[model samples]
Target: MSPARGGWVILLSVVLAMLLSVVQLPQGTPDWLAWLRPNWLLLVVFYWVMALPHRLGLITAWLIGLFADVLHGEALGVNAFGLAGITYVTWSLYERLRMYTRAQQALLVLVLATLLELVLLAAQLVTLGLSFEWMGLVQTLVTAVMTALFWPPVFLVLRWLRRHLKVV
Candidate 1:
């Protein structure tokens, strides 16, 4: 398909990621499984920002983040800021990221996810007056690790779609 026709794939993937990010496991699911949930939107935005740096910019990221905040029922602008900040970093390093091996990319994803989590956590603590707990912190680490673990397969699928659809 032409780039013009295929561009919507980006939007579609992002929407799906947003939905998946908030999707809860079935009833009676273990709490540990919840901690294993990766931030799907973060992974998708990272992929697209890296794959199409020229097309996906900070504004688009901010919009996506705003919607994410709504979806997650967080204080408005909290996730928006985090996503935009991460998106900016990814956009700045797109060339280098593209050249990195999958392992390296996953490592970076871990670091990036950790940073984004910290930002969002800090914001929530401030806005919601939430107390910090060690378990919460541990969950953050688990989430980052889980997100990083998911990076390879997510990268492959998005890469395949980008190539298969001839999306620019």
Candidate 2:
């Protein structure tokens, strides 16, 4: 595929991921259940960075993170910083990431997600001066587990998309 077409396809996927990220849970859902929400944008970004490291890098991640910040109504640059951090790590390790088994990749995803959450929390602490909540750690663990569980399907589907669409 032409680079332009491939770039658009990747951007569309990122946009969809952003939409998924902001989707609201049903009313009256338990708080714990809410904490289990996966960071869809991060998962999608991870896939693209792994799949097409040349095309999707820190800039793509930063842009998506800015959009996520707006979509989720968080402080500007919070998600940008966290997502950029993850993307950088993914890009640096793309070859190794691709070689790993799915299960191993999931563990890496969990670690990356935890780090992302910590970055966001630290940003909140600095910007909003919000006292740290221990519950935030639980939320991070829940999000990590959910991200790990969701990774295989996401990886497969994105792999299919890359193949079928001929995304370079």
For every candidate in turn, the CA RMSD to the true structure comes to 1.8, 1.9
Clash pairs, candidate 1, are none
Compose the digit string of candidate 2's lDDT tens values, residues 21-121.
77778889876676777888889999999988888879878988998888877799889988899899999999998899999999999999888877777
Q: Model 1 scores what on Cα lDDT? A: 0.89
Error of model 2, residue 163, in angstroms = 0.9
**Poorly placed runs, candidate 2 (over 4 Å):** 1-4, 28-31
lDDT values for all models: 0.89, 0.85
lDDT of 1 by residue, 1-168 (tens): 334557798999999998888787999988777778898889999999999887788999999999999988888898888889889999989999999999999999999999988887788788889899888788788889999999999999999999998778
Best by lDDT: 1
Give the clash total for candidate 1.
0
Question: How many pairs collide in each candidate, listed in order?
Answer: 0, 0
- Looking at candidate 1, the ten consecutive residues that score lowest on lDDT are 1-10
